[model samples]
Target: MTLNILSRQNTVLNKFIAQIRDREIQRDPMRFRRNMERIGEIAAYEISKTLRYTPRIVETPLGQAEVAQIDDSIVLATILRAGLPFHQGFLNYFDDAQNAFVSAYRKSTKDGKFKVKVEYISCGDLEGKTLLLVDPMLATGSSLVLAYEALCERGGTPAHTHVASVIASEQGIDYVTNHMPHQTTTIWAAAVDEELTSRCYIVPGIGDAGDLAYGEKI
Candidate 1:
């Protein structure tokens, strides 16, 4: 798998990221969700550059113009709640693309460890399509791998897969690269932090994205 770290260069993306990470800014769920959506939009735009395109002619009011149009059929998939806003960003741009959602969560075990369980999925056939699996944060990466596996099992194999996240830990990145299909997968993240708490939360991450964007669960 290939990795693209966007934060290596300074850009407006950092501003969106900073706001999401701000403790005070997290108070406004609206702003938090908006930022995630904006990041998703930006990420989608960047990922577009790597996709295949073909020239096409469009008839304008005055004349016909040639434009390069995306040729790959895209399926935008997300890991439930937290990935919602981020997925929206991609959807805003890939409006015509098919959509998929996976529900995977950490199920605690008796030893205080946890396992990712993919319990729900909603998707069309993924055969020969371009899959964009998106999540707001990549902490342990287990949930992501599980989600991807579940998606493929039900929808068939995609032509290519792009794994996207707003922030990730080194461990998480390493885990996915080793676990995902190396030849057909690419990873994109706005920033990468080096630490993960014992419980598998990214240190200095924007906190629980699902809770921050929505509300604390009971």
Candidate 2:
């Protein structure tokens, strides 16, 4: 089944594209990761603007004024290893929100094809909460689904879920639309690329996200 894909377009998102595409820019792991984080920061701000708020009075140096405050409790969940930096961006804005982390790996068999496996998960209660699931790359989306399922099993189903990604492939978007629980899920991607390589990497994607953010693993 096809679903609505929300493309986050803005000057900051364009900047993310420039950095992710430049060969030299990607060489510096630190900067590359920070760029991803910055993208998250910008997206977070945009998303927050649309959230529900209530009037609250605060005492200032001069006077007290009523202001609307975000009413929904937030839970930031990141698919680990690669998602750390991206997650950091969300955390920067959601400093007071509860945090959850999940580790997933793509397991391959003899045929060279693979499946996602959820290895580690840590989360708090999520019932009636708003959750933001951050993952750097949305390639095949199998891992994203697995991570979501793992979190739900551990932390109860959230009232709403926002899947955030730096780059997404069409196939990956399709996969998530088909596999994820659609009633409460909405996808927000910085950019959408048209390619999915034979090995499941988004073409022109900033290579291995974990490698770019962290380093090559043995």
Top lDDT model: 1
lDDT (tens digit, per residue) of candidate 2 on 31-108? 888888888897688668766799999999999999899998999999889999999999999889999999889889
Off by over 4 Å in 2: 1-10
Query: Can you list the residue pairs that collide in candidate 1?
Result: none
Which ranges of candidate 1 are over 4 A from the true structure? Answer: none
lDDT per residue for candidate 1 within 44-106, as digits (tens), equals 999999999999999999999999999999999999899999999999999999999999888
Counting clashing residue pairs in each candidate, in order, gives 0, 0
Q: Which ten residues in a row are the worst by lDDT in model 1?
A: 1-10
